[model samples]
Target: MQETRVAVAGTSFPAVRQHLEEMLPGAVVEAVPVELLRSGGCAAEVLVPAMCRIDAAVIDRVDGLRLIHQWGAGLDGVDIEAASRRGVLVANVPAGVGGNAESVAEWCVMAAIAVNRRLPVLQRVLRSGAAWGDPPGRSLHGRTAGIVGLGGIGQALALRLRPFGMRVLGVRRREDAELAGRLGLAWIGGAAQLPELLRQSDCLFLCLPLTEATRRLIDERALALLPAGACVVNAGRGGVVDQAALVRALESGRLGGAALDVFEQEPLDPASPLADRPDVLATPHIAGVTDSSYRGIARRVIENIHRLHDGRPLLDCVNADPAGAQASRDS
Candidate 1:
């Protein structure tokens, strides 16, 4: 029996190695740092990357690489075209994994409430020894929350927010009446109804993917549509919102506040103006990263490894080049 070799790039998550070891007894899992990935030192048949930009150059270095398993749902960093051309299948553990969706939804809700309650302002005042009641706060009860995507994460968030007596509105690329009805959404529609959602929502949550259509989906015009002093919580990809426009809105006080887990440039520049604003809450992109989520993702990866060992198709295979994938499998 040949030992399965897995290379984990970019992240230093100990759980990944431990899980792979316990699940695949003879598997060799190497932790490849970001520097090695950048310099093209990935030598493995299976590559699992977390927050590492897997471009054409990196792919070229790994000769026997057959799979690119993303550690999470976000795949904006992976070059799907390059992987497809190189006959490497790309897979991701989507939000359907209960833990991942729930974690992200919880984070989104926390962001919304934190921003609306003016937590940042209160913290600033407390630290500066100023009057405690300088900034008035608001509550989510009876307010409307517009979710930009009606996917698993959005639905989870809606379920969590309902207990607070909040009205949830969702918009997706395609309208699903049954899903909306099941979720008990106030209203759900396609992109055409986004303007209405913006106008009505007291708090807006962005949960959409980062595609060409969704890139900069929340720009100046969209921000202007929001009712004054509206709060924005973005747990989706950073590129989905126009950073410059968002900064302008925050700086000019056109928008009340924002809580962002993702940014246009990750590890957001220390000198970035958005980092300094009292009304803006910036966090390292960690909405979907939790202990339970990692365990769930590990199970998926283990399942895929079993399938690969048995010469069967992998789960959640995003880049489907049947002929090419088959060739790689055979090799």
Candidate 2:
């Protein structure tokens, strides 16, 4: 029997390889540099695209490529239509499965508070030995928190924010009355009600994935709708918010501050204006990179691999019809 060839794209997160090797002792697991993969130098039966874009070109170049599994929830980089057409199975470990959602939610809470309290300004004040209490901060209590995307992370955030005495307002692709009632949300609406949510919220939380509809969802107009001095905390995809428009809003004093964990570009360029702004608290997309999340993700990946070998259905498959691909391969 030939050993399964598993190629993990990207060099970051060495623990993924470690976990895979420990679980699948007989499999050949190797970390393929993202640069090499982009250059069409990787071939594997199973590919874990860790923060690497898997476009049609890369998909077609690789031989014996059966699966393209993302290490975590974000699959925006993968060209799903092309993968489906090529009979390649694409799957992802959804948020909340392995404490990823909770971890990200925790980060969002911290960020909201940090921005509200003018943490960066305080830090600078302390560093410069400035007068104590030079700048005042706002409190989270009794403020309206508008959560866009009501998915796993959004739901987690709502639950966590309840204890902070915040009035939670949620906007999801679809409104779920039961879920809203369960989360004790002040109001829940669909995409169409986003503007209303913005107008009422004291803080805006972007927790949705980046899709065609959601890309630049919070453009200049949307930002303008937000109450003046309202803070923004984004734990979701960076593209969901218009970076340029956000900069304009912040610079003009239309918005209070922003806490951003993800950006339009990973490893945000140091030269970018968003990098050094005192009002902008930036993190390098580490909201969901906790040990518990990775371990849960690794276990799911391993299970799917075993299922593929056993001719069973894959878990969390995003493709329209993965069985079609499996049948094509078998035939």
Candidate 1 lDDT over residue span 30-82, tens digit each: 88888877775867888887567889888887768888888777788889999
Best by lDDT: 2
Q: Kindly give the stretch of ten consecutive residues in candidate 1 with the minimal lDDT sum.
A: 321-330
Which parts of model 2 have CA positions greater than 4 angstroms off? 320-331
Error of 2 at 236 (Å): 1.4
lDDT of 2 by residue, 180-241 (tens): 99999987998889999999989999999999999999999999999999999999999999
Q: Estimate each model's TM-score.
A: 0.93, 0.93
- Cα-based lDDT for every prediction: 0.84, 0.88
Question: Which pairs clash in the backbone of model 1?
Answer: none
